[model samples]
Target: MEQVKVFTIDELMVATKNFKEERIIGRGGYGTVYKGLLPNDQIVAVKRSKFMDEGQIEQFINELILLARTKHPNVVRLLGCCLEVEVPLLVYEFISNGTLHDHIHNIDGASWYSWSNCLQIAMDLANALTYIHSIPIIHRDIKSSNILLDDSHTPKISDFGASRLIPLNHTHLSTVVQGTLGYLDPEYFFSSQLTEKSDVYSFGVVLAELLTRTRPLLPVRQTDQNCNLAAYFIQSIQEDNLFDILDSQLIVEATQEQLIFIANLVQRCLSVKGDDRPTMMEVAIDLGELCKQPTNLSPIEREM
Candidate 1:
C-alpha cells in the first residue's frame, strides 16, 4: 500500500539497521534481501546486490527501468531504488509470506500445499507473465523461487534482473543465454535467440513442479549425479506414467480430467520448438479457466 519513490542510502541504512545480519530475509546469487522498516513504519524488502561488473550495470539499470514501469497485482511492486552507493539497492513492497518454493517443498513458512493453492499460484504467475509479455518484455527467468507470496498466499512475481524488453518490430532478441539450468528452454539454449516462448518453457517446468512437488533438480545415486525434472517429466508423460510423477498429496485431490488437461497444457509449453509453444497470454487465459472450474473436492480433502 505504501509507495516510496526513492530513498537515500542513509535512510535505508537506518531502516535496515545498517544491514545487520539479523535483518537479512533472503539470499541469492544477485544479492541479499533485508526486511526493513521505513520512517513512517512502512515495511519493505530491500534488495542489495553484492557487485555490478562492467557488463552487468546495464542489466541492473534495465531491471530498475522495467520495475519502474511495471504495474500489476501479481508482479512485485518496486517502490524505489537507490543509486548513490557503489552497490545499487532496490526497495520493494514486502510480501508477508514466502516464495512458492517454500510452500511446494514444505520448507519453513509453508502453510498449505493443496492442489487448489497450487492451481491459484500457477494462475497468478501466468497472469503476471501475460501482463509483462503484453508490454513486450521477457522475464528471462521464471521459476518458483522468483514467485513471492503475500499473507493470503497471493503470488507476486519478482526478480527482473534478467528481463529484457523486446521491440515491437521484433519477435525475439539475440542475447547471451541467461536463466536457471532446470528451467532453461532447449531452443534458446541452443540458438541463443530469446523469445517470449522461452518464458513459456520455463513456466512449463513450474507446472511440472506443481504436479510433482519436486525440485527441478534431483539427487540421484551415491555418485553425486542429479536428474533434470523437466526431462524426467516429459519422459514420464510420454511413457504413460504421468501419474507416477504426480505429487502424492495431489493424486487423491485432483480430478482425472483436470490433471490430463493441465498435463497436456504443460506438454505444449514444453514443446521442443518454441514456435509450437503457447503464448503467455494464451497460457494465462487457459490457467484462469482451469482454476475457475467447480470441483467436488472439499477443503479438508484437498489438504490431505
Candidate 2:
C-alpha cells in the first residue's frame, strides 16, 4: 500500500489555477472537488473540505487513513493531502470519464456505458466492496455518484467520507445513520445499526439503476408521490414484469437469461434483512458469472 504524501496547499493552488470555477469538477456534502495537475504532471482530483466541523474533519482523516492502507484496482487511490490550508484537502487519481450517476442520469451523455459496460463496472465495484469488507471496513455511502468511471468504463469506488472501520470482533456498529436518501438501507435507517450489509442494500439499488436507468427517487416535478425505485422494482420482479422495467436498449440488446440472472442477484442484494443479503464477495462472484453470458444473441436464439 502507498503511504499518502503531504503536499503543500500552494502546490495545489498552482495546479488548480488558484481553484478557478472551471477547475471544479464536482460538489457534494463533503466539499467541492477540483481537477488539478500535480507538480509531477499527474492529473488529480482534489477534494477540498467545506465544513470545518469536527465531524467533517474526522471523516477526512478517516478516509485518508483507510484509503492509504488499502489498494485495489477498483478503488480510487489517494495520492496525498494538504493540511496547512484552512480546510484540509485530499488528492485522488483523476478519472476523466465522470461518475456512474452522470452516465445513468444523462442518457445522452457521450460517457454512457453500454449494457455490457454496466455489467463489467458492477463486477469491478463489487470487487472493491469485497476488498474493503475483507479488511472489515464498511463504506457507509455506496451510491452511483460516489462511483467514478475510468476511460474504459472501469468503475472505481470513491468518496469514503462516511466510511466506517469495523473492529475485528464486532458484528455491527451503532451510529447516527448518515447516507443518501434513496439508497439508504431501510434496516439501518430504522435501527441506526450499520453493517457491511448496508452497503449491499445500496449496491442493490445501483444494480436497479443500471437495469432501469431510473433514479432511486422520482423527480419532484414528476409526481406528488415520491417513487421508491427499489419497492417498485421488487414489485415488478414479483409480477414477472422485470423485463418491462428494463431500459429499452437493454431489453433488446441483453439476452433473457442474462437479465433474469442479474435480476435474481439484485433481488438477493436487496433482501429486507441484512443477514438475508448476500455478502459483497458472493454478489461480486455472481455478477462476474452473469457478465460472462453472451448478450449479442437474438431473443429466439437465446432461448434455443
Among these predicted structures, which one has the highest lDDT? Answer: 2
Best TM-score among the predictions, by candidate number: 2
TM-score of 1: 0.92
Please provide, for model 1 over 1-304, each residue's C-alpha lDDT reduced to its tens digit, 9 standing for 90 to 100. 2354878999999999999999999987688899999989999999988776754566667778888878999999998888898767889999988888887888554447778888888888888899999888899999999988898899999899999989879999999999998999999999999999999999999889878988888768332333878877777788898898897667777787788888889999999999999998899888888887765577787699
Each model's TM-score?
Answer: 0.92, 0.93
Which lDDT tens digits does candidate 2 get at residues 133-229? 9998899999999998888788889999899999879989999989998899999999999999999999999999988988998555433343777
- As a whole number from 0 to 100, the lDDT of residue 104 in candidate 2 is 89
In model 1, where is the ten-residue run with the lowest total lDDT? Answer: 218-227
Error of 1 at 235 (Å): 1.3
Worst 10 residues of 2 by lDDT: 218-227
Considering only N, C-alpha and C atoms within 3 Å, which residue pairs clash in candidate 1?
A: none
